[model samples]
Target: MAAHEKMPDFDVIIIGAGISGINFAYRMQERNPELTYCILDGRHEIGGTWSLFQYPGIRSDSDLYTFSFAWRPWTGKDCIVHGSIIRQYLEDSAAQEGIDKKIRFRHKVNKLSWSSSPSMWDCDITVNDTEKMSLRSRFIFLGTGYYDYEEPLPADIPGIHKFQGKVVHPQFWPDDLDYADKRVVVIGSGATAITLLPSLATSAAHVTMLQRSPTYIASLPTRGVFEAIVLKILPSSMANRVIRLKWMLFSLFMVSMCHRFPRLAKSFFLRETAKILPPGMSLEPDFVPSYNPWDQRLCLCPNGDFYAAIRSGKASIHTGIIETITASSITLASGKELHPDIIMTATGLKLRLAGGIAITVDGEPYNLSDNFTWRTAMVEGLPNLVLSIGYTNASWTLGTDSTAHLACRLLNRMRKRGLSVIMPRMTAEERKELEERPFLALSATYVKEGGNVFPKTASTAPWQPRSYYWRDLAIARWGRYQERHGVVEIGLVTDLSR
Candidate 1:
């Protein structure tokens, strides 16, 4: 007879092998080479969200330098990269760093249970929608984005089912969707709708962008002069740093300029937009947004492609309320009808927490709103959990890298101190007294539609997202992280000596 010793699946578990998870894992593995880890994603491959979203002309809204990892300098000439290119970059990086071998794909986590008796996480997963798998780990890093995977938010239009041609959402774009030499109507004016308009217009007989109101649209050259000048003198890596700093500062200045001189900026943007519109087409009553710039995200069209589409008479913009969708077209409230061959609803995403997994700590289910975020990584009272969401205002990867690196630093510090558990122990008084704000500060339609159900941010340190990229970079990268302030603590479960 023999007694067998059990072993956990991994020393650390990071969910979703997207850019965020990959970067965090790299940082963690570099800091603690002894720790064994696994990366799990519901999808059958890495690239997480990028792999999930497949649509025509789908590309990053943010520039590559800011959107990519700080260490990975994007040497490509195009600042804005296509989704496939971005996906490949992630795949190649993971392969080069040996992180690809650690990924367990097709593992859809259904629940997560954190136990106190033996501090670890029980990650319940469903494989290929049939098989059940249970894995355990000492730490759980959730790189699962806030967007719901099941479906996009319901923006029910009258008679959508009656439409006979075709209806598509960018989230689940069919591989066989064809609109060549056909009329198409794209509903909504967000980034998706904006991207789709020019893309579909290239082959489609005509493409119509039908929106209820307007969203702010801005244009910049595909490549910046600042980057070109720096790369000429500096090495690619150092040139990247110089370009990123200048770009970041320029972004901050633009944001400040928008706030202080809204009218001046608004006038300039509309003027630029008017340059590419069809002759005598007023930007007002169609392109001009009622809200201020950066209220919702400003749509970016590289090389003025979106504007050039209209200028070439390949596309049209209609700002009117939709009455309903008919068999082959849409009916506006103004008694106008748009007969089109295809319809695309770019309504927005359905926001969800932890990919809608049932999470419990010590047998009690937790609500996201009940816990304030501690430095955008850990939630109040949640032990050994790090949320890897990105910035709403800046490049998503910028925030991702900062949060990932900071979490790695904390994990390394705990190992050095011989601590088994680390948690942000919030004071009850602080919880009651601290000013509460929405976790996502942006006024985007997606956030407005589905973000209320998620967590709330605090008005103070370690809880509030400063929203300033430079200020946050300093705090997350080099702040004096201490537990004596009573915000967070590290614990030794048993005897102090090993």
Candidate 2:
């Protein structure tokens, strides 16, 4: 290759040096070491989500066995790994694999445009908050996971700006704020809220959880004997098989727990919760969720921090409509007021697809919403764009690994055929059929209007892989890899009509 003044053009440009990005880059290089690639990350370091969430007691909801990459098994003692450890693992993995040198930290991609003349992409990126640079590549891989951008906290309440203690969003937590000896109010019942309350309660005078509606909560052993057995008796390959089996069985048990005996499931939670509450405190129906189990994500407490806080009388759960916020207090719908020195909004994240990257084909913008039949993260009509959206119900990494493996296969196939672009090409009938059939619709909030878009595959619980892992694995491993659904062929520029 000839040297140029600017950075050499690469065969691929990967956004976000997080786990998915790093892993995908490694796979691409493994397949073809000669293919040049570069990774751009907004943060000064790797680890993506793990690096961003620095709150106390932050841990993985999924077990480490399934949460980690298949290539690198987790040898850590704790099955339910903490955020810091996960961050360290990811960073270490990158360094040990010699993939860290390809990464450009603090380089944030702002815009990407595809050029048909050279069959390449012109990526405009910002680095270190100052420099503006452009890079060209034949392929673009978006490893920017969701959750980086947060939903706007609606401040329509009566007096949000008035006497405010420290108002914090979990996404943008203050580094210097002291929570000890302060009364804290945590708003929202999502995962972040569930994880934060117990940690805050230890130092805060009191922590109150506010929920607008009920959500199902489930608990499992943070560390299990099965993991130990795999490490002791089974070889790595055999251990993976046993781990997969355990995952399936546990998934089934969860399904049954939610369906066959919902009341039993509810009681189980209540009883466990009561054990950690101070005397006279009970798991009241007001605090218990009425929705089906796993309808929303089940809040996890690996070390029983939530119940511990309640048992110590440091935490309380409140369910009601919030009227407004005063300078020093929050008013509920029942005309009651609770004073707090700090307020944390643990609201869910705003979902942005392709990291809000605008993708175009032959200079025409591709609107993903218009083409929604997702097959292994590839839309029906888009070409040369393969996404890694895992099963909504299982571990994120599980599905991501499968997606990366499948992408490797697709890329290999392309290389064998000497093809430039491969686009999904479903017929009108297939499109209509897919449109009519109901889908779980992973991006509900992202939809312009919210309602169930498609019927879930399984009406009964546990049988379905609501998690991205299950769905992606099924599609990648068993679903059609052949160009049957719809595969469009692209020719070189000299042969193009334009």
Candidate 3:
């Protein structure tokens, strides 16, 4: 009587109700209709990041055309929209597809352990913050995103404790705090900070963006004239597909150009940024970054709104190391001081993998760093598991959908073959020749600071780091799963009687 011999609760258990989770559920149901699956979310609601961050002017850094779920398609007029709108769209998407019913909200998965006897995964979950329960499933899909939702990247300011005024972190913004006509200082030059500047500038007497180093900011339109014309002429479904493809190609092209011609891309970015800045504002101290283009993600300023705030004389940009923070002011290394009524730390996210779920195999702990990712979806040496992580270079949903479809395809193969277990393994010879690399290609602070939270990447196929969406999508659809020196194997199925 082994632990896994008993019938599992479900065929699959997805670990988050966020964008990746919802997308996985849809793909699983579509491709494998007979398979039973449930989504477990730690939060009470559906939207993950969108529901979590409620700061003013929070929006998607990528265009909604590609960022939105592929099946539902974003019908909004604006390509870049507010966080609330994205949440509403996700809610509607889940409800319309009946996926919302499959979610078990507030059921936090604490740990997952794979039992080899019957080849099922045992899940330890906490329901409603009080009751503890255990469940079993044949497969576990980790839709848990790559960031620590509970804790953001710590603010590294020297004297943050001494600040008397209202201090806030964008990850945990207070809803009731009003900053009307009050001086505000936003820390960091990332997308969140850029998005917050123009928004806070509208109501605040003054807003200053405080960054230790300059980051490249690129202006993008909320709605393009070409897209508008295409929407007007084409049918709704056709128009949605057209716009999505357009943005997909554009995003890929931009990233490729930046990588292939770094000098040209840097020049173009600098030229465009200078045009939008206030007259006489040089690019040296505030706009120029020491790194090459696409080394880190470029901060997107929708419609030049952040620049508009600066031109209005309500917002300013200051780049210098923080010396100290007193009761009401932040002193810079260059002796300049900024007095702010509200200090918003839009610093960055704390990167984490599988939402910090402790994983085990055969009663032994499984460390993620020890394994290599198989096609950026499945991990080597882990059985019946897949991690759905989005791309940093392109739209997050594209990578998620690719992984989802690939998982479904693998599941279909296993079911048709009467196989109960699927595991990614590597030969000893192959392991020796494999070159391990960082999971993410970006040199962003958060990615570097994450410190091996993600699994390692290799230099070869199905193990190489995830990059462009088109190539990954192709691999997901038609790549050889059994080849590649037998990287993935469909293990024995003894539970056919069930």
The local distance difference test score of each candidate is: 0.82, 0.68, 0.89
Residues 131-210, candidate 1: write the lDDT tens digits.
99899887888998888878888877898999998888889999998899999989989999989998999999999999
TM for every model, in the order presented, reads: 0.95, 0.86, 0.97
Top model number, lDDT: 3
* Model 2 lDDT per residue over 347-434, tens place: 5665566666666766787665566544545565565666655545566776677767666666666666676665566577654543
Clashing pairs in 3: 375-462
TM-score of 3: 0.97
Residue-level lDDT for 82 in candidate 3: 93
Candidate 3 lDDT, 312-419, residue by residue in tens: 999999999999999989999999999999999988999888989999999999998888889999888898798998988888999999999898988887787777
Worst 10 residues of 1 by lDDT: 1-10
Winner by TM-score:
3
Q: Sorted by lDDT, highest first, which candidate order results?
A: 3, 1, 2
Order of all candidates by TM-score, from best down to worst? 3, 1, 2
Residue 295 lDDT in model 3?
A: 92
What is the overall TM-score of model 1 with all chains considered together?
A: 0.95
Model 2 CA RMSD to the hidden true structure, in angstroms: 4.8
Q: Which runs of model 3 end up more than 4 angstroms from their true locations?
A: 2-5, 494-498
